[model samples]
Every structure is written in C-alpha cells, then in structure tokens.
Target: MSAGRDDDAQGAGAPGDAARPKVSSVLFLCGMNAIRSPIAEALARSLLPPTVYIASAGVRHGERDPFVDAVLEERGLSLGEREPQRYEDLEDGFFDLIVTMAPEAHHAALDATGTASVQVEFWPMPDPSVVTGSRDQILDAYRDLLGRIEQRIRQRFEA
Candidate 1:
C-alpha cells in the first residue's frame, strides 16, 4: 500500500473479499470536461490499478480549465495531453461503470446505458466555476472540489 493511504475511510472490502468485483473500465462524466470529470479521471489514474481502463467526458464538449491544470499541478498531476471530449466523441462508449458528477451527466449516462447492463453512479458534485472571489478564494474552491472527488475515488477504489 502507498504511504498516507487509509483503507478505513469508506470501509472498503478487505483483502481477499470475494464480494467486491474488480472494475475493468470506468467513465467519469460532468457537464463540462473542464473541471470535475478530468480531475476525477486524474485522481483515479493515480489511485487505481493500471489494469483499469479509465476515461472521462462531459455531457457536451468544453474547453479545458486552466484552474484545473494549476490545482492538479499542486499534486504533481497533469492534464496536458487530454483534450476535452463529449460522450458522443468516445470511440468506445462501453464501460463497466459510469460515474456522473452532475445531474445532466447522470441523466445522459442513464440514457446512454439504456437496455445495457452497465452500472451508473451519481456523485452530484458542485461546479466550482460559479464561485467568484479573490485569487486565493478561487483556488480554494478548486482545491475543495479536488478534495471531494479525491475522497470519493479513494472510498470507492482504495483498500
């Protein structure tokens, strides 16, 4: 296990627990790929096993947020190579799990998974873009958003 990891945060499955199945592919979605979904994707990339194929998208296409790049830089994470993509842009739209961070994304994921066996989880995250304040305050909002998504990712995948 990596240093500073706490397995008890979410009561994740114990070692050798047969009840939890390994997740192969996952999709993270939000209203825009600018902030939430991409951050979640980067967090998952750092935490989850490489065997898991992880990708993120928005309900509609959006430009990458520089605040996202700046905040993630504080964690030594980068999104330099990732271009924002919409659900319709995914070449392989199939995934074992679709994690949505916004209401619109949740509904879209539901519609996309109709008649399919995929699992859809709604996380209902806040959009930090709506926040207006000083430079520190704005960065704080992004940091808070990053923390929330990081916690959720750790809870669901860490053990």
Candidate 2:
C-alpha cells in the first residue's frame, strides 16, 4: 500500500512532526518470479522514482515466461536478460516492503522474516498460467493480469 504520513495535530506541516518512514526498497514476491512478481517489479521500477529500489523473487526459481515478455513489450517495458531468481538467491535480502502476489510466497516471506521489522503484504493475484485455452484467450488472460498489476502499483505507490 502507499506509504503515507500522518499530519501533525496542529496542522499539516507543523514543526516537530516527523514524517512517516517511506518505503525505500520493495520486493515483489510470487511462487514463480517468471510472471506476476516480475511484472510488478518492472512496473514499480517504471512508476516509482529512481531512489526507490525494486526487485522480484520467487519461492523457487522458474523459467522466464515468453508471455510475460510479450505483454511487457506491449507496454514498452522489458525485463532484459534477467532470469527468474529464488528468494534464497537474492543478492540483497533487505527491503522496506515485501509484496507477495501468491499465497505460497506470502507464507514464505512471513516465515523468512519472522521477528524482523520487515513489512509483508499479500496481494492474492491469480496465476495466468493456469488459464488453458486458445492462444488469443491465453494472451487475454495475461493482459488482464498485466492490467491488474499496473493498477495495483499505481494505487500502492503513485501519489
């Protein structure tokens, strides 16, 4: 969710009112980094300022999905040559927020961060890979997922 500051009792910017801590780094997590999490990471990187660090990881490493690449290309975004990474493979383990799009990822994040001050949020996104149909219908499912992720990123990060 969007990080917000509480106004001072006196006024909006009264003296001695410390601003709330902003989310400087975020991790988008899912069962497989191939789709949802990667999409979120790319969108957040594009939407948020450069000062905000964004990354994505999965509970287990998965092969990159071509559908993800196709949909991202439609929006002028790309993951480049990046491959899906597992949570344990992350180069940097610290983040201000860890947004899990899958139930498994949420559980894993909570378990991994037990007793740590990290914030974890479960977003409950559906897996587009589960949609079996014609090529057009499958692409539509991916597109729908892409739209949902974009909307969520805007709601949670953009002013």
Candidate 3:
C-alpha cells in the first residue's frame, strides 16, 4: 500500500494537517533496521525541521546494508556509521508518532503502544533485497524504495 494518512477516526487532510496531533518526535519502524527504517530516518532528518526529533528501529536488528549507504549517498544523506537497532533498544520509548514500513513492525508497534497516545501508521513497502538481478538492478530496487520513502516523508511532514 502507498504511504498516506493514518487510518484513524481523524479526518484526512495532509500528513501534517492540524487535525492530527502535534508531532514533536517520530519513530520509523520496520522488520530490520538495515534498510527501510534507516532510509526513512535519514530522509526525515533532511526533510523535517531540526526541531523535530526523528529516529528509527526494527522489530529486530539486522546487519547494515551497503546498498542503503549507496542510495543515501546519492541524495547527499548518510546514516553516519549507525548500526541496526531493535525496537527494544530505543533510548526513548515515547514518540508522538510511530510509522511502520512492514507488517511485522506495524503489529509490533500496535502491541507495544496499546492504550498509549502514540499514533501508529503502516506504510506497506516491498523488500528490495528479494529482488534478484544484476548489481544495477539491485541498486535500482533500493533507489525505488528510497524514492517512495522520500515522497512519503515530504507529504507527511512538509506543511
């Protein structure tokens, strides 16, 4: 599914509409920190205001993907030697919003934030690693993922 407004009772306008709660902090969650979530975190940092706190984590940690670095570098962004981290590894448990990029992360976020005020959004994205082809083809998949995430972040965060 494409990234859009949270499927909540609140009416949709844009991702940053006044109808939504004020977001001071956001957490991007995925199955592994190696790819989607990290890409999101980097994009958000670049797109959102400096005052907005942004971080990313996974249901479980996985090895850092070099393709992620390549794509981010193409955009002049970087994760700065950051390592993959699990959801449980987050230093601050609370966030105004939690955006999940995978089904497992979405479920994990929902279970972890039961009854809490946090708004969790599921943005279904394909796993680029599953794409088997030439090196260029693999990079293209990563680039596609990067583009989607970047578009979503702009729509959701930019006023």
Q: Write the per-residue lDDT of candidate 3 for residues 1-159, one digit (tens) a residue.
A: 223336442232255466766789999999989999999999999888899999999998699999999999999999997999999988899998899988899889888987787778878778999999999999999999999888777777763
Please give the CA lDDT of all the candidate structures: 0.82, 0.81, 0.85
Show where candidate 3 strays beyond 4 Å: 1-16
TM-score result, candidate 3:
0.90
Candidates sorted by lDDT, best first: 3, 1, 2
Q: Give the Cα RMSD of candidate 2.
A: 6.7
After TM-score superposition, the amount by which residue 30's alpha carbon in candidate 2 deviates from its true location, in angstroms, is 0.3
Estimate candidate 3's alpha-carbon lDDT, on a 0 to 1 scale: 0.85
List, residue by residue over 39-96, the lDDT tens digit for candidate 2. 9998888888999999999999799999999999999999999999999899899998
Best by TM-score: 3
- Number of colliding residue pairs in each model: 0, 0, 0
At residue 87, candidate 3 shows an lDDT of 98
